[model samples]
Target: MTTQSLDESGNDDTIDWLDNGPVKGKSAPTRMCLATREHMPVSRLIRFVRSPDGDVVPDLAAKLPGRGVWVRADRDALAGLLTSKSGFARGFKQSVQVSEDLVEQVDLQLLQRCQASLGLAKRSGAIILGFDQVRNELQKRRPGWLLEASDGAQDGRRRIVGLAVALYERVRVATALAGEELGMAFGRDHVVHGLLKTGQFTDVWTKDYRRLYEFRRLTDDVWVSGTVGKNV
Candidate 1:
């Protein structure tokens, strides 16, 4: 994407963009959300492109060729565009086909990124596994974040949160992924509790998870079992 301009004149041009996240060694760029028609930091938006077949496809990396459209990470915005099926048509200035499953694709893609980052953090010895191990770690220091299974027993979650309260350790817990889903990163059949030490991988995983959170809720694919606690 060198340096391009956006205006009501409908001039869409290529501009140098860093798709992985925020830019470095250069100024951060902004793109307009087709659904909201608002300008925002590109890092908070996802890019889409039209294939030769006139099919709308998500370009999360923003490296796809051709004129592309940007949308807010929010699933509602994406769904609105797809529901009416005009946002892309207006942006592309051509009749296009929005994939019915594009929203799911975006959700799964972001989840995969989170899973990959979690695996990397684990490989670097930054991950604490099991309820006992996580409890021990929490007693010593604060972690980047607390990870719990979305489909696990609430007892483990309540006890952990209670421990955090007692230690005065303010921590954020995430249960967006199921126990079995998280286990994939560790080659285990199931994992209920986990913690990540503050580091680069933690930041990466959190960012991806936030995007997924905005996009949509998990499906039966990643959420297999357990009662996801609300208060804990």
Candidate 2:
């Protein structure tokens, strides 16, 4: 199944695999960004659709029903979607209400999705919380990813990351979320450090984290999935 919308140039855009959007081990197909006019993997784009009340909304999971508009997952691309007066109206070929805070909303949505992925890890016994437990996992457990509170002191983070780097081929550390934010997934007041065991949830978390990092980072640096270029 597919859904249709328009790019900035008013070209008919179709997402061939939008029915479920790469769910259940299916490969993600590509969609054209309304802003960039470039076709990229659906995982690298954010889907938008008109709500019942004519409001433009982000369909982060890409499962929302209706014809969908797409933009690259980058913050700049999304912002450019609303630059001209016509903007979404021109793409949708109808009047639509876009919230002034739409960009902020997308950022929060991606962050929440990242946290929700951690919740899945916790439920599956795939997560280790606390500084000491995470450190122990770094030493013994074949961890897939490292989670650290953005607001936590750098001392603990440096030690844990150093150990993870020494032991693993690549240490995927995410410090974009704060202690209280990470804690919400584990039902704690504060969680500064965490480790995720190699499994399905880790992969999901990585994707969400990458999108969040791309949306929030100030620099033009892109987030690559290989060889720790920089901490996210």
Candidate 3:
């Protein structure tokens, strides 16, 4: 559902989507859908506030000395914090230091996590990189997902895309993926090609990717828009 607050001129504004489904009409900050604690399985939908040290810690983690502020997880949700300062401040019942880089921090965290998973996948041999090598892997495993580089050449990417389409549900470009980063996954320092296989590592990567991509799609739809919706 949509959550809203009035702007300086008193106009209603939309908050980012923090929960299930898009909020109708109004904007609301997005909240984490999973449990607050790492040990719990039950879903606790709580909005996290950025701590003074610029850390996004969960309030339930500890009873800190001072009051905490709430923010949605996406960029739009963070933007809501800037525009609807009065409303959010009212909700917190205290003053909060809202920095412009709050959402950037969150974005960085998500990207890092995704990259780490890619690294793990590489270590496990569930992922392969490089043009010819990855294509060969694709032919063998017929992977459930494909990862093309965001900065890869159009014709080169298309040739792989065509192979993926031939294999159906088993190919995608890694738009949020960095060529250099993917290369590091396999012990290299630079790369633009990669392949993903269905295995324990793939399962783990897919789950983490689900959460990361979901949040990314909500805010920065540009990176994940076309490639993520299908195949990968």
Candidate 4:
């Protein structure tokens, strides 16, 4: 993984998740609850535990046995985990294993969860796809958020964005999961256009996306302030 120093002002984004305990804990040992403040979504926050080697694993299947540890599901959160060793260790009340590559694993899990959720949403007709279809959905009513594929053609996405401006309250362009990842969300080999259905599950999905987006932005060396809008 590539590493770059970030401006101190923007470092706060990582800190925000740490304060919130974003990792596996809500439904079971494996399922992580995505939490956020306000109507906007946040990252996948659930409970977790440190491994003997210091690995931060997402207990998706809830099969891993042990007391769970909580982190923000981002690199900075991993850094915090490393820094506050005494606190976390005390919380676990045992010799918890910590891995150096914990952050990378969490990132991969985050992407996988996004893709998997997208696939489920697509299967349930919770997602609308293609530029034209998405445009039509926009006409029906403004959606809670707008999602665009980061790898999509600029012109195509721009056209869709124009339609979204009138129909959606917020827009989020996803870069983590591109063409194939987008398609998997809908059970297709490849997909570009997709919209999510509103429900409790969807709320959690949105929050996870928001957290992933912010973490990606920070790690990518793009310093963005204010709420996420058009462009990733």
Candidate 5:
């Protein structure tokens, strides 16, 4: 079954089941950001705006009023934009107070977005947690994505990932979130591993997951290595 979901702009976007998995129809017109100057999908970029108070604010959902500034949804690119000589001022064509914690703010917002996506997937019955449950699901039917806690023990993670590799040759594994953060998604004290079934929500969650993953890579090395499957 398919459902309609609202994008950031409150426009109805069609979510349909494809042969491979669920996909979201494009909703917004893509724009090139002054920072990157590359035409790309809106989902792959972050938006910003100048506040009336002469401060720059992140319009992550792109709903904020006034002229919008676009930046690549990448940690390094954002950091570079913030640090570059007059990057924000030049982009907006006016001097504005850029928050020193802009990057951190973006990271926090992206983290929350990812966590919310996971929670929605769980509520929709599209996610399964625990080692045995995920293992069985993988063996029976390949999942759209695999998620491992960054702080999870290596042994359990390896076992599950190995099973995924043996079954599907390649599986996308997301280890961007820690166990506690993942626990929030499952309403538990902690979650070591999880699986997202192929569906509309999985597609939405994957976008947030990739942003969080990339943001973490730029700021910290807290992620556990080998947990992210390259094959997928």
Candidate 6:
């Protein structure tokens, strides 16, 4: 199913998918940004609103009250919006003070969003942790995705990746977070491998996961190296 939203100009716009498939269930109607003029799913957009003090605040949760504006969640897109001649001011229809660290702020918020979603997935029992559990789960059913600590051991990651690849043609392996971060999500000291099962929680977690993945890619800050299985 598709969703529609009204742009700043009061014209109806259809939001397009940025991924191969639409997220299951009813997502809120999408938003159109003044900077890009492209209607996109909210998951692919970063929201900002004028604070009571007239400063532009990043509303990662989209819960803040006020007239809001959205920018595509890309490094270049946000950088352009901030650098453009009066882009944000013109869009909000006011002279708002944009934060100098807006890009960093958005990146931090997106990271937190991804971490929170992973924690939620663990609580919902939609995730399996450790190499043995993940490998066993894969044998029973195909998971939605595999997660490996950026610093995890090459041996275990390679084994799991090979198994996932054998079962699914295109397996998503998230290596942006470290083992400690993954452990925090699963309520442990550290975790090197995890499997996200296909279910309701997967739908929610995947959106944040993809956003975090893209954000890291755009910023060129993806995690690259760490000792594997040190916790084991």
> Can you give the TM-score per candidate against the true fold?
0.77, 0.82, 0.62, 0.62, 0.78, 0.74
| Residue-level lDDT tens digits of model 5 in 65-117 | 77767777777788877776566666665566777788999998998898889
Give lDDT for model 6. 0.70
Kindly list the per-residue Cα lDDT of model 1 for residues 1-232, writing each as its tens digit: 1111133455543333223432345464888788887888766788888789778788776667776778889888988877763557766766677777778898878778778888888889999999999999999987777788888888988798668656753566677878988898777899999988877776677667766655664453222221132333
Better of 2 and 5 by lDDT: 2
- Per-model RMSD to reference: 7.3, 5.2, 9.0, 8.8, 11.3, 9.2
Candidate 2 lDDT trough over 10 residues, lowest sum: 15-24
lDDT of 2 at 131: 87
Alpha-carbon runs more than 4 Å astray in model 2:
1-25, 218-226, 229-232
Q: Please give the CA lDDT of all the candidate structures.
A: 0.72, 0.75, 0.52, 0.53, 0.73, 0.70
Backbone clashes counted, model 1? 5
lDDT (10s digit) by residue, model 3, range 166-230: 76653444555566655655667766767778677766566445545554544443334334324
Better model by TM-score, 2 or 4? 2
How do the candidates rank by lDDT, highest first? 2, 5, 1, 6, 4, 3
- Candidates 3 and 5 compared: the better one by lDDT is 5
- Candidate 6 lands at a TM-score of 0.74
Q: Model 1, which residues run further than 4 Å from truth?
A: 1-27, 217-232
Better of 2 and 5 by TM-score: 2
Per-prediction count of colliding residue pairs? 5, 0, 10, 27, 0, 3
Pick the TM-score winner. 2
TM-score of 4: 0.62
Which parts of model 3 are misplaced by more than 4 Å?
A: 1-47, 50-73, 87-91, 169-173, 184-187, 214-232
Sort order, TM-score high to low? 2, 5, 1, 6, 3, 4
Cα lDDT tens digits for candidate 4, 1-232:
1122223343222322122233245632232222222222113344564456654455543346665644444556556655553434444443445555656666776678777777677666677787788788878865544556667677877676666654453554444557776776666787766666555456667656755665564455221332244453
**Candidate no. 1 TM-score:** 0.77
Error of 1 at 97 (Å): 2.4
